[model samples]
Target chain A: AQSVAQPEDQVNVAEGNPLTVKCTYSVSGNPYLFWYVQYPNRGLQFLLKYITGDNLVKGSYGFEAEFNKSQTSFHLKKPSALVSDSALYFCAVRDYYGNNRLAFGKGNQVVVIP
Target chain B: DTAVSQTPKYLVTQMGNDKSIKCEQNLGHDTMYWYKQDSKKFLKIMFSYNNKELIINETVPNRFSPKSPDKAHLNLHINSLELGDSAVYFCASSQVEGGETQYFGPGTRLLVL
Candidate 1:
């Protein structure tokens, strides 16, 4: 079984400030990790993924995530936050050698203060 | 163009009633999935289909059934809906052989009274 944990319930960042959201995972074999963002009343949009190689994965809308194998963590980051960045963020993981199902973490609500 | 889409953005019904949610993906993907988001915003996978074949079925009650008539469509049917079943249901899809990123559709918010 694969699982993901997002430690924070919400993250508040002022506009133009750096933003970060934490995520951890537990999987049997290698982990295929992904990040998604959901706006209010909209579907989740694919942001980025970490399948193999490239610990620093850059994604849509100036978002980037670092995959740390040793720490069992994949933390999302943005250099500067924008008010439009306020949304729900989710982290997901799946066993590379296991089933196709993805285990998602409880989302983190990001509030970018303007 | 919308890659994935779902019908009936909001569903309000009484308990014990049956309802269906429809999903379609036009990204030429081979896999489709159904996920539920609870009131607390927790998301969980309920069912998945690969090429119109059931692939992943999580620990869910038998009252929920999923049907995939073709590669582009997967519909969910619920029987004897309970209050606990109320949640936002999202449909997603991915090309199993191409990449791992799954595209999602606007969720269907079901409210059971």
Candidate 2:
């Protein structure tokens, strides 16, 4: 079984400041990690993913995440935050050769203060 | 164009009522999935269909059933809905399978009263 954990319930960052949302995972085989964002009543929107090489993976809306193998972590990051970036962020994972189920984290609510 | 879409965006019904939510994907994906997001915003997969064949069925109750008339459409029906059954249902689809990005619908919000 694969699982993802986003330790923070809510993250607060000032506009133009750096933002980070921590994530960790536990899986059997190689991990396929992903990040998704959800606004108000909308469903999850893909942000970025880390499948193989390049520990630093960039994604939509200027968001990025780093895959730290030794730490079993994939933390989402943004160089400079915007008020519009405030949303619920999720970290999901599935074993590379495992079944088709992608386990999701208990989403972190981001509040980008203007 | 909309890659994935779901019908009855908001559903409000009483306990013991039966309701259905319809989902469609125009992305030409062969795999689709159903997920439930509880009040705590924790998402859990309920079922997945690949090319109209059931591929993944989690520990969901038998009262909740998923039907895929075609590869592009997947519908979910619930019988004897309980108060705890109220949650947001999201439909997602991915091309082929494993490790691919899954496009999601706007989600169907169900409220059991």
Candidate 3:
């Protein structure tokens, strides 16, 4: 079984400040990880994914995530924060050899204050 | 254009009633899925259909049935809806199976009284 954890329920950041939303996963075999963001009353939108290759994966809207193997973490990071970046973020992991289901975290609410 | 879409964005019904949520994807994807988001915002996969065939069925109750009449549509039908069954149901689709990015719909919020 594959699982993901976002320890923090919410993260507050001021505009122009760096932001980080933490995520970690446990899975069998190679892991196909993903990050998604959901706005209020809207569906989740794919931000980025880590399949194979680079540890630092860049995504849409100036967002990036670092996949740390030894730490078993995939934390999202941004150089600067914007009030519009406020939303709910989810972390997911899919086991390569398993039944092929994407297990998601409880989600983290990000509030970028202006 | 909307890649994936679900009908009846908000559904309010009484317990023991029957209801259905419809989903469709227009990204020419072969696989579609149904997911449930509880009040605490926990997302879990309930069912999946690839090319009109049932592929993934999680620990969902038998009262919930999914029907895929065609490749682009997968509808969920619930029999005797219970209060515990109330949640936001999202429909999504991916281009392929096993490790693929899924496109999600706006979701249908079901509230059972």
Candidate 4:
């Protein structure tokens, strides 16, 4: 079965500091990975996705993620964190089975403090 | 205009009652889906429809039935609602079945008394 794993339950970072939220996946074949962020009492918003032909993918809200095929990892990163960046993050993967469904990670809560 | 929209932002009903949550997307996407967010804040896919055809149906109970009148709308109907059914339900739409970004709605909070 294909699945995604977010190792960190929560991450705390200072404003203006680089932040990284780790995520790894397990799939039978090549993976199409995605990252989404959720604000309190709001729906999940798309951040970025890595389909192919690019190790680094940039997305909305000044967010970017690096895809590592060797380690089956797709970690989300931001150059400079802001207090507004504090939210819950989820990593997802679309398996080769072609169900048009995505397997999502448990999710990670990120807190950016001043 | 809202790309995706769901009706009854908040629902509170007694147990064993029936209710329905309606979803509509004006993005003209070909696929729509329903996801449940539990009390622990875990989101899980419940059902999906593509062009009015059932595409993905997860391990959801039969009490939960999804109906898609058209490609742009997918509605969830729950019969004999239970206490465990209290959670926020989100409706989403995508261009295709897989490998595409999904647009989500504001979500509907359902509570079973």
- State which candidate has the highest lDDT: 2
lDDT of 1 by residue, A81-107 (tens): 999999999999988876678889999
Q: Indicate the docking level reached by candidate 3.
A: medium
Top candidate (DockQ): 2
RMSD of each: 1.1, 0.8, 0.9, 1.0
lDDT of 2: 0.95
Model 2 C-alpha RMSD to native: 0.8
TM-score of structure candidate 1 = 0.98
Off by over 4 Å in 1: B97-99
TM-score against native, each model:
0.98, 0.98, 0.98, 0.97
- Model 4 local distance difference test score: 0.92
Q: DockQ for the candidate 4 complex? A: 0.71
Model 1 alpha-carbon miss at residue A47, Å: 0.6
Which lDDT tens digits does candidate 2 get at residues B4-73?
Answer: 9999999999999999999999999999999999999889999999999999999999999999999999
Instruction: Give the winner by DockQ: 1 or 3.
Output: 3
Candidate 4 local lDDT, B1-113, one digit each (tens): 99999998999999999999999999989999999999877888999898999988999999999999999899999999999999999999997745789889999999999
Which ten-residue region of model 2 chain B has the weakest summed lDDT?
Answer: B95-104
lDDT scores in order: 0.94, 0.95, 0.94, 0.92
Give one digit per residue, the lDDT tens place, for model 2 in A1-114.
898888989999999999999999999999999999999999999999999999999999999999999999999999999999999999999998877799999999999999
Interface RMSD for candidates 1 onward, in order: 1.9, 1.0, 1.2, 1.4
True contacts kept of each: 0.70, 0.84, 0.81, 0.60
TM-scores of the candidates, chain A only = 0.98, 0.98, 0.98, 0.97
Off by over 4 Å in 3: none
Candidate 3 residue-wise lDDT at A19:
96
